[model samples]
Target: MFFEEHTGLHIDDQRYRGSGTSKANRMRGFWTVEPDHVVARVLLAMIAHATEYECVPADMDDALFADVHRIIARLNQNPSSPVPEVDAFTASVNELDFEAAAKHIRTAIEQNEPATAWIACTCFR
Candidate 1:
């Protein structure tokens, strides 16, 4: 267990050993809570965790970037579906606006097609 070994300390190795930059990025979006304004602290318990499979392998590229955008779109959707971060994310959604990050998310999906779903999932998170 890399996590156990690195408890309170940064091991920065394995699977992502030499790819902290990408790994740092791909690690986000573990949450799946639906959208809502005035985010509720009560939603903190819903945080989701990405699986090792969902970690987005160190080998990512343009196409993979595109897929990440798609995930952002879905996350931006405020869909009826509920995920862990939905509420925590909603609180920040308003702040995250203006940048139109959601638009970027869509563009990444439409323009690039190779981006993996996991990358997209991490994009917004």
Candidate 2:
């Protein structure tokens, strides 16, 4: 509903199913086709719609901002194994590379999390 209402992109069930072959995968395939910013914006909108608390990423504090990105990264990750993004995230933590870890989190959120969240929105609607 949000995708069509806001972004004008219809979610065909078959096509969407292709995005995540199984329920456990959390829909990583959306990034392979859609633009990152678009997916992020749609996810943000859906969050605002459901929570009634809109977030402006620029207005978030540094820690809060990074935390949100990390949350998103975690949600998008496969439960069965570590993906490259998760590996990089773990390496950054092991090396105490705060900036690199933050970058990895942000990139993972931008590329994967939002799209997966958008798909999850279907359950509610």
What is the lDDT of every predicted structure here?
Answer: 0.37, 0.51
lDDT of 1 by residue, 1-125 (tens): 33333222232333333434454432322121212311211122111123334655457686966775565555445534333332233424466562454445444444433233225546656
Q: Can you tell me which runs of candidate 2 are displaced by over 4 Å?
A: 19-27, 53-66, 69-125
State the weakest 10-residue window (summed lDDT) of model 1.
37-46
Candidate 1 regions exceeding 4 Å error are 1-60, 81-125
lDDT of 1: 0.37
Candidate 2: clashing pairs of residues: none
- Over 1-125, each residue of candidate 2 has an lDDT whose tens digit, in order, gives 65678677655445556546663232344545455455565566666775575545555677975786675555445444323333332332245455544554555454556445444333223
Clashes of 1: 17
Q: Which candidate wins on TM-score?
A: 2
RMSD of 2: 15.2
